[model samples]
Target: MSSFDNTHITALTDLINKAVQDIIAEYASAGRAVPSLDTLESGLFQVPEETPARLTKAIQIVEAACAQLSCTVAPPGSVMINKSLEHEEPACLLVVTEARIADLLLDKPEGLPASELASRSGLDTRKLTRILRLLATKHCFKEVKPGVFANNRLSMKLLSSDTVSSIVCLLTDESLRASAYLNETLTDPSERDGGIPFIRATGYPFFDYHKTRQGLKKGERFPRAMVGWGDVTGKGLLAKVYPWTSQPANTTICDVGGGNGHVTMNLMKAHPHIKVVVQDQPQVIEMAQKFWAKEYPGAMEKERVQFIPFDFFKDAAVQGCDFYYIRSILRDWPDTESELILKNVRQAMKQGSRVIIHDTVLRDAVRTPESSSNASVHHDVAPEPLLPNYGVARVRTYELDMTMMNLLNSQMRTLPEFIELGKRCGLRFEKLYEVGETDLVEFSPI
Candidate 1:
């Protein structure tokens, strides 16, 4: 390699080595080994309540540097080809999840023949093998022996019992379907309304489409999908990071546009002293009532939690709650609608009341503190030889931004963009709490 190439590789390798050492030290201190990837009970997937910030930062460095090093050393043509055909992986994953192949293999530790899998899943033997083979290449499943397959740690995540399977299906089904029309929607001059891609593909906007008969069926699966999403996205860690225990007992939290109240349920479960008022659409609140009833019946019976129908765009959230928590809500709409929602929340805020918007804040491949005036919170920027946004380590945020575009023509905002939006709604940015993959941005009434 040339001197320039050597320099880049040295830096990237150094970053990787340091991060690995940090991770090893953490596990060693805890008297635990780093979780294995081969078994379903590895324990890595179950995120602990308190994830050390150092450990999270170390993992981010390892992911960013490794991907950067790969791109730097790999053949340019091969990299381009891999990127071009990347969509095929999700397609294969869809087949595995939809077929309930993981669940079928739950009791079969030894593995099963491709023919047996095909017989059970009702798929052609050869084609089914091809799909499994493709996914196995990605380490999502494993070929324990030639022509025999079994679920690995990754594949086990797709079991029908896992909420993540619902998310996998949602992405591969509706999100992928709408993504096919993204190009056409952008190019078509007559595609005026936002969500044109989803509308063109499904004949209705995201919310409206979900209300139709077909949408209702998909909607039934969506809440479970959100729970799965929260798990994978480290959203459940919000309860741990946000210091809910510091709030006085019985302090009220209004979950604005909180879907099915899964995130709030996590909070309530962790800190039983805090009360919650879960607000969403009528149908969603109805479902949420049933969810709370089954999960924590006393929360409803004692009036510690209330499920109320709310239209944030047209009406304010429950008035004067200690904290207004909105998770994964604003990203589904464009700026105009997002501003309206914030304004309404602002309308109901008391002097000490605060609004917490929990979502991913997008980062660029390169950034500097001086890049934006609204860069009030300091974010960790990757070192040289790695993309500043930590590349694939932070890929989920970018993927979610695209999902929003595919479904609703919305986006994950940058810090500056979020601040601007809040300013428009008479809310000022208070502070930002970095939980893990997502963030909790606090805002107070201006």
Candidate 2:
């Protein structure tokens, strides 16, 4: 690997040019205009599925190259200064999202003045100006003049109607509060509940908090927020990554803890031949049934997909499923509970059965990634001087890791860690699928 110096500048430039040209060619072929930074239509932040894969990689490379170069040449205190001001960004977002400032500015093409905005929103004018200006500098909003703000594409997406806004509020509010207590959990082992920070901050486990949280029917928001987050960060990777096309006509997949069965809905929509049984708690299953009834009536009526209530901790009643799929479930518990969840799924398997686990498979900066050792798991490691695990490019890996610890005293696992846990329940490693922010590993009876 080359040092982080100008010696690699030409190579970076060439890579950037190639990706740019490739993207332009695709747009030209499609008879579409190349999108600009001023517009949200072209960016990769929360792209639609119809976007071309090569273009996504191209945009990512451009951002990574620019960021890597900027960091390398940055003077002392650059990193530390960034760390110190981190809280301010989330605070700014929390204010705007909660206050519905984005919605207020949405249709005002001429831009909204600060004083008027404050009057309408019932916020103090001076305080609101400071908050909006901070985010406008980062392209989230546009400061048309000294004290006027307008909704740009990024900010427009945060309108009160958007679910991503709810996610932003949730992460930066309760989740953020819980994150501040991580050290308390790590060090104060003797303090009650083994220092689980989410429980410490919210007085309820993460899932329980979602179930009992009161608001605009808080029960519905958590699942909807999850789908929004998955779209923004992951692009519904589970829907895209699996080889659903290859599944046999009779293939059956049991979606364990599949809240509202959104993932299964996507799968059934894409691959009609694959049958699915989505399981969750009784209440969540009720929600899923209503969802399927409204959104995918055919799938439910045809019996190609259905929602069933299953408590993951109990012995399995689901039998003869070709694939038992779990997503974002295990990371909500420590190992002992996680093992029990696996053992229950184990009890229902027959020959040719496989369990597909969809969650984050964290890679260490120093250790070789499991993808290198397993032909089945495919992912992109950062090129050249960038960290192999994508460094700052994928810091969400660690962010979610902390969130897991804060909420449940659980963890995102390394391959070896996952293997060890699976082994405890008479399951063996079968294969792995590297989805976006998460991984899908298949395990079978030893």
Candidate 3:
């Protein structure tokens, strides 16, 4: 097989392995004997005529065991039990909630008792414990014992006081507001006014709202979360994706809609020879200046970077920049809005200038089941397809896409969709650079 074919097979195989492992773990945790490999292989080949009665019995047994163990395994009444609601949890909620906890822990640094934590959060002790317990399962925190929770690496990243905490807050709030009206929004497809999207849900566009609410004060933790996320991930791009080493000295790089200039700051730090213009709204620019002054004082004065206030939807003010960098900005917009943003960037560029887009390009694939006796046994006794096309991978991507749709009415673009969007904006799409899991596409003026 060709390398591409081999790669696909390997990815598929790994996914299957992981799925199997998860199944085995679930069954074992429930105190059930695993099924034989022969039974599993036979089940894979011969589709079951009905939902396997044995599998149902096994789940019941497991659920009972879980109850006896007093474990918080999802109950039949839990939202996860309903196939439809399984993915409704907002991604931003996860980010923001974790960030809030992180912030609370960071303030104390030495860790607070459960009572103190509840008091500080303005949430009841019981409610806080339940939430923390759930988060602990995901490693966001560690339950020191029955009643207390401590911050972990993931939770630390989300702490509100951390520079990145703002991004989490921003995303979480935006997600929550949008999710509140998801059902209504979906029922009315023809509605031009996105009722609960970031722009409509908040009564104004995100940037405008941010203008009234200053950073760290406006409770706009989501934007800050996004900026922090970008900063952490942008470094990976610099080290592995962007061709920073090849770029000429005295190069002017424009960061379009670059909120708070965190990404630009990192880029300039990596490539000191390159000059940068951090562009955003007037209010955001003012905030960005404060951030730059505080975080990167002498570097800005040295002429390595300057903050410029310009709306990307308007005429481009980024003229003569060798690279127009937009990271994690376009994903929150629909095709029409994305086109406008790209058009502005195109107009600002010289012939050879590159438009570097750093965003997640989700793909359709299934997760593999792991190689374990429990997994093999569960597969043998389980019904065919388990959850139909509703495996872990599909559920994850679909849920995230749904959240984006509800909040911004935006859809995650496939590679081809991205190319088409670029074409619509009169930019020629070039090769894609893979940085970790993100796809960084380079474009030039057509």
- Tell me the tens digit of each residue's lDDT in model 2 across 1-446: 54655666666677668878988877887886676545634244354465666776676677766766666667749866977788888888988887899888876867999899999889999999999999998888899899999888888767878878878877777678788787876788587655788777777766677677453344465655676787676645676778878889968899998888888788878788999898889999998889899999998788888667888898584888999988888887789999999999989999888888888898777536464665755766666555567666677788878877776777889877888999998889977776756788889987
Per-prediction TM-score to the true structure, in the order listed: 0.90, 0.89, 0.62
Tell me the deviation in Å of residue 222 in model 1.
1.8
**Candidate with the larger lDDT of 2 and 3:** 2
The sequence of per-residue lDDT tens digits that candidate 3 reaches over residues 65-128 is 3332222324646533554542333352353365366666654434666677778767677766
**Leading candidate by lDDT:** 1
Where does model 1 exceed 4 Å of error? 1-5, 30-32, 48-51, 192-195, 207-217, 370-378
Ranking by TM-score: 1, 2, 3
Kindly list the per-residue Cα lDDT of model 1 for residues 205-248, writing each as its tens digit.
Answer: 87788899888878888878887887776776877778788899
Q: What is the lDDT of residue 166 in candidate 3?
A: 59
lDDT of each structure?
0.85, 0.78, 0.62
Total clashes, candidate 1?
Answer: 0
Relative to the unseen true structure, what is the C-alpha lDDT of residue 197 in candidate 2, on a scale of 0 to 100?
88
Candidate 1 lands at a TM-score of 0.90
Candidate 3 weakest lDDT stretch, 10 residues: 38-47
